[model samples]
Target: MRQNAERCTAALSAAVSNYVDIFEHVEGQIIHAHQKDQERKRNCVMMPSKKLQTFLSLPKKQMKKSLSETSELEKELGNYTCALHARLSPNEHTAIKNSDYVKLSESIGTSVKQAKKIATTVKLIRNVQKQVKKPEINPSKEFTMAALF
Candidate 1:
């Protein structure tokens, strides 16, 4: 009878230890996930700036093509005041409103009305580029890290 009691006590202890190990593993995973989430949030702060820079730096032909593609959709939807237009400065608004179609068309390498739209889009992109702060990097710190590696 005493041996049976000891066997049962040992089994219970083993089960308790197993449960503790599982709990600790799960806790560690949760902490790791939280840390990853925080790092993602930090990185996302500069995502808009990166996107804006990429768009602005595109080749002129590619930029014009992108603007033309969106212009068709804008006309179909009959939505003239887009998010980009909404953010335009007063001067940009006036420029688009009173733009010389022939001059703009020749300069932008597009049709008359499409040239106006492209000009507006370019202005909006430049405005956003100005507004979005670029991430600063310390060259000395980067050099130190590279040296460590």
Candidate 2:
């Protein structure tokens, strides 16, 4: 049995010298993978700067676009509110104008105080719109969306 073990050891040593190194092959594969990983990291790192430049530039253009959209929305809201106010029957308008909070609240499906407050606010906004519409106004005098809120 000892002789057979010695022969096997000798065959293993011979095979090691005769064949490609298993450890070296594995190490090469590991190194190749590491290099691929580094290259991928490098490629990924380069992309963000170009994307950042575009991303940064977009806000300026988008700000202008968003501002215009906001203005359009404000205009539409004003027109819609004016239409709503106009559509109110004389009886409903009289109830709000008379400060009859209970009747207004019941009619509008809101709390007494809340209904009165909302009606007054809408009335004031409609008045502002009326004044603004008649004139080719100064920019400073222009009614902005901020005042509505």
Leading candidate by TM-score: 2
Clashing pairs in 1: none
lDDT of 2: 0.57
Q: Evaluated with lDDT, which candidate comes out highest? A: 2
lDDT of 1 by residue, 31-123 (tens): 997786555434311112443445456775555555456765324222333443443344444556566556656533468877665665556
Taken over the whole model, the C-alpha lDDT of each candidate is 0.56, 0.57
User: Candidate 2, which segments miss by more than 4 Å at Cα?
Assistant: 1-74, 136-149
Span of 10 residues, lowest total lDDT, candidate 2: 44-53
List where candidate 1 sits over 4 angstroms from the true fold: 1-3, 44-61, 64-149
List pairs with backbone clashes in candidate 2: none
